[model samples]
Target: MQKQKTGIRHMFTGTLPQVVASLTGTISAVNDGMHYGWSAPIIPILQSDDTPIRISKTDESWLETMYLIGGIAGLPVTIYLVDKIGRKNSTIVSSCTSLLSWILIALAPNVACLYVARFLSGLAGDMAFVATPMYVAEIADQKIRGLLSSLIYLMMLFGILLIYLIAPFTPFYVPSIVGSLLLITQLASFSFMPKSPYYLLSKNKVDSARKALDRLRTTKNNEAELEDISRAIERQKKEKGRPQDLLLVKSNRKALIVMTVLNAAQHFCGISVMLMNMHSILTEAGSVYLKSTTTAIIFSVCMLTAATFSSFFVDKYGRKFLLITSSSLTGICLLVLAIYFNLKTVGYDVRSVSWIPIACVMAYAAVFKIGLGMVPIVISAELFSNRVKAMGMTIADAMYLIFGLLSIELYKGLSESYGYHVPFYLFSALSLVTTVFTIVIVPETKGKTLEEIQMLLKGEKPVCSNDDDATDNLTQA
Candidate 1:
């Protein structure tokens, strides 16, 4: 018989605790996705005469833009507490806050309460985005890190897909009720898991960190490699990860530039605007696909399929490869979409191939998940030192929110002034720029350990290139 499969590499399949941590963490992402999909289907309902909170187009715009502002508001709070309180507790609090936001939405009697609730939910979304990845990255075995990192996006896609499927048919309040229940489940499931071993080790709780590592590892106690992990942490202790250091140090600066640029580029590509407002664009496309909710469902399904693929293949394929491919294809699809919209607006009578816009959106969603959506997120996690990871990630997360705001605002303004094709053309150009940047600069971190990643980010000699013996080189570096 072949040698029995047993070690960190099998944490996704063969280890119990690692599986538990990932599942518990991903459950919260459904809440994040619901926050996204909430506005898309409900916007029409709120704008119609049959609503409880009657308002103008301005209020409706606020409902969408407030989420981005809330994301911005949440960064300072997360930065203050993430390292101080531990990733597990911060995550638990994020779940509770998100639940409250939904509950507030359920109980809203006026527009003011709804606005407050949306902002709170935005805060919760950003917190989850910042904390969940850090916790998972720290606790996960290097072999399975790529897969687990992709889970946050996957779960968020499921949440978006969930709302699209159910909310359009149900009463206005039902979606909020169901989202609240999901958050409750995540809170309960997550309370049982341990904090990040890196966090614990940083806090000088060596025994606790070791126990956390043992639980995450498949081999009993992970007895042989535990000491090596402790040693790697010791090496990282020399790198004081203050916020200013992230900007000043050459290696840290390089990683920051790459991380910051990738995060901003993702939003400039116009995915979030498409995500929330795709149905409206579909309706305007004047296709048979717009007759029912099928178009929305298909687009969502395409995204889920792509995110699922990334959840499996990101590690095998590596970050830079996927980023370049995803960015390139996304640019082409956006260009096609721009031309399609322009032709239709000019009375070109292209109903013979009305399917082009829908097909482009679906293809764009699928290819985006494989790389642009997943790689920046995973690579950013690898760039920061543990000492200032909260700050580094908070800055990255903030840029995502700020750029998202610009994307949404720009789409609305440009469409109002010059037609929808303008934003599409602009995003396509940005995607091309992103593709070239990926080829020239983004470093690969497919199988590297966290310490090895930190070393690489610091512009020091890389400790380990592959996950197998990368840790053993930490001391040498």
Candidate 2:
């Protein structure tokens, strides 16, 4: 019985990689819609006198602020509901809300309606960030947990790439319409998507969790898996605690600190800001629209490489090494770009300039996707036990989305006022700081169980009854 239980747990390691993959379909549609809409037809739509909607500088500022405000407002509610409703159900609701937002944005008659649409989108965005990774981590076995968590970022990169592809050719309404349609599809199909068995067990729905476990696993040993899940649930019930309580505990405090710092650092890495304003950055570098579009494609291609390679290596290399290496690489690239900007400011004028900055930016994006871009999401979910998973993720995401708002606002204003290179330099300095933190704080969870990882984080030795051989695979490459 014990051996079979261990074997069933081992299956979770294999299940890790599939977690983020589940959301790819939804991610690709919404992400493309949001980014592509902003860069492509929306601009023309807003600028046209014939159009019913017109966006002034004031309108743009208000729209952005509304989105940020919505995120701040939604986090607490999402945290509460996820615990009450379960991961799968929460996602279905959020995705549906997002679908409605897209439709509203597409059919909006005035600036007021657009703000409401964006606000709704912001709510869904916050939900996705918190719920998706949490769902992935809860379902994943420890061995490849980091790799599984990375799927969100991988899917996100694909989302961004799809946007770049569709933006240049499609009409303004096309992306939003597509996003809405995809949302409908997701809502319809989610009936088939199983709820997180972990959540079920947490709620004492043991029979249901077992059924979900069976469906997700789809292998032999149903009785053994049920026993293992029951044991895990028993352990969790002993630790039954609130998110705030766990965060205040001495051992869990360290996990909180590490996760918080890492989450902040992920955004501070600057790739996100750059992505949000890719066209504007290219324009500053003297690239016209056509050239800017070409540069976006190149950047996306490089990012895709980083995403693919990271997915392959995350399980092999562990999280810490990849994070440190990627941070160092990103920092160096930012510093170089800073130098380029300094030269330009000092009066180096020539047309048909080298595309060095563009290339460097692409490389930086790729490196980020491999490490920092994906690590925070996984870490946040893993930091707490099931009792507090939703809340922990909620707090982490709240901080993340709040910082995200600041980052975007700062990027928009600072790029216009201080200079492009300055933001890169700032982000580079942040990356260095984050690298130091990663080395000193973050632990490797490659091939480790959630309980084992929690124990490891608490400075206790984790005893794995099954898959002792798997530990050998966790060493950094």
Candidate 3:
């Protein structure tokens, strides 16, 4: 019996099952990334005679705005679906929505169809975005939680890279069709995946949660770990996280506010538009001589490379160090970009150093990916309890789209009205703010369990398992 118990414990720590679950849960995110990146390459096609649609400049801006607005509009639907149906089912629903959107895009005859297609895709993305981080947090082991959660960003960046790479080589409709089939394949595989143990526990299905955990864990020998999960759920159930919980409770308010600020940081940094506009930005940078498609591929490659390092090293150096350092450097890069563009607009023969803008943007993408890109999402997953996790994510994502909408409009307007540097200055200031907020307010969560994180957010102290200085933080608290 002892040997059998040891065998079970040994099997529990295996990483393969956890990795598979992580990828399965992220199918919607992959599709979302593909859709967002699709816009930049597809825009010029809509203007060309290859398609019947003839979109003006103003219409193009609306096309950009439409996806964000659709995301905001889909929040309530996402919240209701995710909360009512459980994370796994909501994820499946999101994948199907994406599949449909791509089908529409593949067959779109006019601008109106394209508009509706973009909105549907955005709705699907919102659903996936809200569900993925929480699902990852619930299913991943404490040992690899941060890393696995950060993998979501990697998957997203890969999707963008995939589409951008394919677009230049293949016919335009091929990527869309390929994307549709990819969703189909992913959805088919995801159907066999297990549900979140936390979500099962929330429904009082203790035995089922155990089975789900066993399916995911594969290597832990001790019943003690499972028992600890039970105890953690019991503690979290005390605060079921009603919407009023956010307003009435101090701890809840802190979690909500902190998450909102970080999310706003993610948006206001201007990476979203930067990724989408990579092609256009390079073309217009005047001094950067790379072909437009090459620029997009390069940007995606840099981000993907940074994301790999981030996912591997996040737990080693801790989230706080990466966030602070990356954001500060990102700010400096953006400031330089602003100056370069300003000088270029004034005809200062900035071509003497034609590489400045490309170098700045590439550096900015790398630094941002290491910390700001993934840490905010990881933090969001760690902060909320199961009952309120959906609500919390919905609120944070709403803030994301709001600022995203503003940045999209502002980047276009300011670049046209003043200079391209104007928007970078705005982004630089926001990056500075993000860096300071992270340093001042964000708590470290190196190896704490979801429950311990809850206690930390609830003003109780946590002892970190990874860092020797963790006890000092508790005492400081």
User: Using alpha carbons, what is the TM-score of model 2?
Assistant: 0.86
Q: After superposing candidate 2, which stretches have Cα over 4 Å from the reference?
A: 1-41, 49-52, 222-225, 283-290, 347-353, 408-420, 465-468, 471-477
Give the top-scoring candidate (lDDT): 1
Model 3 poorest 10 in a row by lDDT? 468-477
Candidate 2 lDDT for residue 7: 52
lDDT for model 2: 0.70
User: Tens digits of per-residue lDDT for model 1 on 97-204?
Assistant: 889999888888988898998899899888888888889888876667888888888898899889888887888889888998888888777888887888888888
Q: Which regions in candidate 1 have their CA more than 4 angstroms from the true location?
A: 1-13, 221-224, 342-349, 467-477
Q: Per-model C-alpha lDDT, please?
A: 0.82, 0.70, 0.80
Task: Check candidate 2 and list the clashing pairs.
Answer: 142-448, 143-447
Q: Write the per-residue lDDT of candidate 3 for residues 303-341, one digit (tens) a residue.
A: 999988988777667889999988898899889988887
**Candidate maximizing TM-score:** 1
- Give the winner by TM-score: 2 or 3: 3
